[model samples]
Target: MPDIVDDKSEQCIRFLLDCLDAHRKQHAGDDAPPPPFFLGLNGVQGSGKSTLVSLLKNKLESEPHNLSTAILSIDDFYLPHSAQQALAASHPQNPLVQHRGQPSTHDISLLKSTFNSLKTRHPVALPCYDKSAFAGQGDRTPETTWTRVNGPDQRSIDIIIFEGWCVGFRSLSAVQLESKWSAAVGANMKPAYAGRLGKLELESVTLVNEALRQYDEVTDMLDAFVLIDAEDTQYVYAWRLEQEAALRRERGSGMTDEQVVSFVNGYYPAYELYTEALRRGIFPGVEGRQLVFELGKDRRVKDVKKI
Candidate 1:
C-alpha cells in the first residue's frame, strides 16, 4: 500500500480533532489532566482502517496539536489459543464460534480491565494478538511482549483510538433478530439478491448475537465514533482479495484465493446481521458525535456525513 493521505483520512481527522477540542473544553476547569479521548473507529475488513489509523496518529502527535495517542484494537482482545480451541470444541455445531472472527472468541474481561486502567492514568500493558501464530488461526502473544503506555518515561496519553471491524455493533432483541433473519432468507432466495445471512442457521447466528451483548459495556465508554461505510457490502470480498494478492506478491506466501473466501465467510455473517443497524447510527440522540464516510465500490468517498 502506498503512504497517502486521501479524503478518508482528511475527513476523519477533521471530525476527530473537533471532538477532541470539545473533549478538552469539558475538563477545562478541572485541576487534574483530562482522561484520554476515547474514539471508536468502525469499518469492514480491507476498508483501509489500519492505514487511516497511521495517518491519524501521525497528525495528532505532531505539529501544533501535539498530543500523545495510544491505539487499542479489538483484534488484540481475541481469546488465547487453547481457550479458542476449547470454544470451538464446545460449539462444534455452531460454525460462528468454530473460528475467531465472531464476538464470543474474545477475552472481554481483559479488555474491560485494560479500558478501566487507562481511564485512571495508570501504567497499563496493552494486549497483543499474533495472527500468524498457530498457522494463522491466531493466538494472544505473551504478556511480556505487550506494549506498556502512560509510564513515567512516556508522555501521558491524550487520545485513545479504539478501532475494530465491529467496534460499535449493537445487540438485537430476539424478535428483531428473527425478523432480520427472515428478511435475509427471503431476499437471498430471490435471484436478484445474494446474501450471506441466509447461508447461516438462526441458532448459529443467535450464539454470536448473545455473545455480542457483553460488548455494549465497552461501547458505552466511547466519547465519539467514526464509521467507514461501503456502498455495497459485497465489495469487501474484492477488497480483501486485493490485499491478499499484494501480500503474496511482496512476501511470496499468503492465503490462496479459496482460503481468502473461506476466511471472509467467517466474518461476513456479522456484517450482514449487525452493520445495517450500525449504519442507521450508533450514537443516537448525541448529535454531531458520530462521523460517517460513505464509500463507493471504487473505494473512494462518495459522501461524509454526521449521523
Candidate 2:
C-alpha cells in the first residue's frame, strides 16, 4: 500500500499539517481547541476514499509530532439493521430510502452524538456496523464491542478522518431540485425510471436532498474536505466489481457481478445528482482547503490539485 501513496501522500500530509497549525492558532484563546482537527473525505463507491484516508491517518500518526488520529466512516453510522427493515417497510413506495445506499438510511442522530462526544472530549464508544454480518444483510456491532475512545490506554485524538461516499454532500435548494426534474423533462428524460419503483426514483431524489439537509450538522465540523474522484462514473461499476471479486475470493461467498451491478446502481443516483456540486465547491460547510484527486479508469492517480 506504500506504493499506492508514493505519488501524492507527502503533499497530502504536508497540507494536513498546515491545517493543524492554523487550527492551533485559532484556538489559542481561552478555549483550548479540540484535540483533533476534523477532516471529511468524500468519494463515490469504489473510488478509494478509505484507502486514501488510511494512508493519511498513518502519516498523521508518524510525524515528528506523532499526532494521534481516529477515523469514522459514514457507512458505520447506517441505521440499525432492524431499523433498515422498518424503513423499507414504511417507505415501500420509495425504493431509494428502501435500501442503505441512499442518503436517508443513516441514523444521523447517533452519528451526531458520537461526533459531539469526541468534539467535547467526552468518552465515546464509536459504533461499528458489520456489513458482513447477518448473512450479508449487515448489522451494527453491539455496544459491548465498541472501541471506547478516551479509554485508559487510548490517547485523545488530535485528528478525525470522517470519510464516506457522501461526506460533503449538501442538499440542493427547492428551486434547484425542481430544476433537476424539470431539466430531465427537457432533455427527453422521464421524471422517473419506470418499473416496480415507479416514481420512486424521482421521489427519492427529492428525499435524498431532504436528508442531506441534516448532514450539515456533521459536515460543518470538517476543517478540510478531500475528494477522491473517478475519471468517469463508469469506473464505479468496474471498481465495485473488482471489490466484489476480492470479497468472494476471501470468503468464498459474496455478490456476483450481476448483483454488484445492481448494488452500485442503487448509489448511482446520488453520484449523478451530487458530484457536480462538489466539483463546484457549492456544498455549504466546506471551509479551509479542498483537495481533489482525479483517478483514472484503471484507478491510478491522474492528478492531484488543491483548491
Candidate 3:
C-alpha cells in the first residue's frame, strides 16, 4: 500500500486487517486453526496480484499487528516441466491436460505438505517455480534456494497471503458442466470451442472439473478470500498482452503475439467457469469471508463489495 500497488491497495489492506483481527479474536491459541490466518487472493493475469501481495506484506509487517507474515503462491506449486509433459502424454486428447495452466498441472500434494508445516508453526521452505526455467517452459527451482519461513528469529507467522489466479476456485458437478456451464462463458466470449472442437472442449471441461476437487483441501482452510476481479473478465487477454509486450521491450524477446494468445486460451476456460461459481457464492464458507474488488478496463478499482 505504501511502497507499491495502486491506491485501492490501502483500502484492501484495511478491509483484510479488519477481517483478520476479528478471526484472531474469535479463535486464538489452541482454538485457532493450525495454520496462520490464511488469506487467499484470486485474480487474473496482469491484475496486480503479485504487487498487491508485496504491498500488503510491507504494510502488515510495518504495522503494529505483532505479526510474522509469509507468502505462498499457487504458481509456485506448478509441477516440474518433465512432470507436466508426462501428464499431457497420459491424456493426449484432453486440451486442459496438454498445458500447464489447468487445475491438474499443480502438485497439490506438495502444497498440502507446505500448509501442514505452516499449521505446525515449523520452519518451512516454500516452493518456487521458475517461469523462465527449462528454456522458458518452466520448472521448479532447487530446494536450497527456497525461502525458509518461521525460523527462530521470525518466530511464528501470524498470517499467510496465499495467492494465485485459481486460489479459491471450486469444482463443478458433471450435470452443471453439461447443463448450465456453457452459459458461464458469458456474452461476447469466444473460447476455443467452436464447431467440431466444441465436443472436445466439453470433454476437457469435465476432466478439468474433476481435477479441481483436489484443491478443496487448500480452499477449505481459508479464513478469508479476496478477488481482484476484472469487470468483464475478458480484459484478461488485453492485460496479459500488455505484460508480454513489456517483457519483449525489456529482454527484446519473449512469447510471440500468437504464443501469448495460445497461452491465454489454456486458462481462460477455467476463469469463465470459476468466476460464475464465485458470483453464486458456491465456494464453501465464501459467503461472509469473501470480498470482491471489481476493476474496470484500465485496471482501476471500480467498486468494492462484500458477497
Candidate 4:
C-alpha cells in the first residue's frame, strides 16, 4: 500500500482501492462468495479516523470502477442511556459504567452479530447511538443495514471501513474492585456511592481492560487495520474538549464548560491507557501507523512505524 503519511487523503484512497483489488483476488474462484473486504481504522478521539474515512469515500466515489463502499462507525453500537442507567443503578459504585464510551458501555453482542451477518451477505439492522443524548435514536438507526449484494453487472460492496476509538482492543477477564471508595479517584463521583469506592475502582479497571480486549477482538475481524496517531495525548485532549463543547452547544444544554471538562476528564484515564498502548507498540496488527496528521501543533506526519 502507499505510505499513509505522503498525502493522507490520496494515500487513504489508494489503500481502499488496493483493499478492493485484494478482496477480488482472494475470492476469484468462489461463485457465491461472502463479503471479503473489510478495513478497521482504530485511533483515539480526534485522531482523524472519521476524516480519513470521508476522504476514502470521496475518492472511491470519483473512481470509474463503480465500487460500492460503506463506513461503519463503532460509536453507533453504544448502549442506550436507559440501559446504561440500569447498569449504574445495579452497580451504583462503578463510575465507568456511567460513562458512555467505555468498553462496557457498548452493545458488543449486537455489534458482533451484525458484522457476522453482514459478512455472509445478509441484511442486518445497525443501531445508531447518539453521543449527545448518550442513547440510541430510532430514526437514525440503520433500517436495512448495508449488505454485499453480488451480481454479475452491479458491483457489490468493495470495501467496508470500520473505524472507531476502541475498535481493535479485546476484552480481558473482569476485574472486581476491592472497595467502592477507590473508584472515586476519577472525576464525576456521586456521594451516594462514596462508601463503595474501592469496589468501583476495581470495576472501573476491569471495565477498561474488558473494553480494550473487546476493541482488539473487533479489530481482529477486519482484513486490515490502520492507526492514526496523534501528536500526543494533549492534542487529542484538546480536540475532545472542543468536540464535547460543540456537542453541548448544539444540544442547547445548560451544562457549563467546567462540567464538560469534568465529564471529559472522567474518560482521560481510559483513553490514556489506549494511547500509551498504541505508542508502546502494544497493538501488533496495524500495517503502517501514521502519527500526527496535519491538524494540530505538530501536524506533519513524522514517522512510519510497523506494528
Best by TM-score: 1
Question: Considering every candidate listed, which one attains the maximal lDDT?
Answer: 1
Instruction: Give per-residue CA lDDT, model 1, range 9-101, as digits (tens).
Output: 767778988988898899999998778899999988887889888888988889877988899999999999999999999988988888787
**Residue 206, model 2, lDDT:** 83
lDDT of 2 by residue, 123-209 (tens): 889889999787777889998998888766778877888988888888889888777666554554454442222223566678778
Cα lDDT computed for each candidate against the true fold: 0.87, 0.77, 0.79, 0.58
Write down the TM-score for model 1.
0.96
TM-score of each: 0.96, 0.89, 0.89, 0.72
CA error at residue 113 for candidate 2, angstroms: 0.9
lDDT tens readout by residue for model 4, 115-210: 775576555444665454523221223445433243445455656778887665544333322222244444335555322222335546665675
Better of 1 and 4 by lDDT: 1
Clashing pairs in 3: none
Clashes of 3: 0
Candidates 1 and 3 compared by lDDT, better number: 1
Clashes of each: 0, 1, 0, 25
Clashes of 4: 25
RMSD of each: 1.5, 3.3, 3.5, 6.8
In model 1, what are the clashing residue pairs, if there are any? none
Residues 78-163 of candidate 3: C-alpha lDDT, one tens digit per residue = 99999999999998988777867789999999999999889788888999999988777799999998999878887788889999
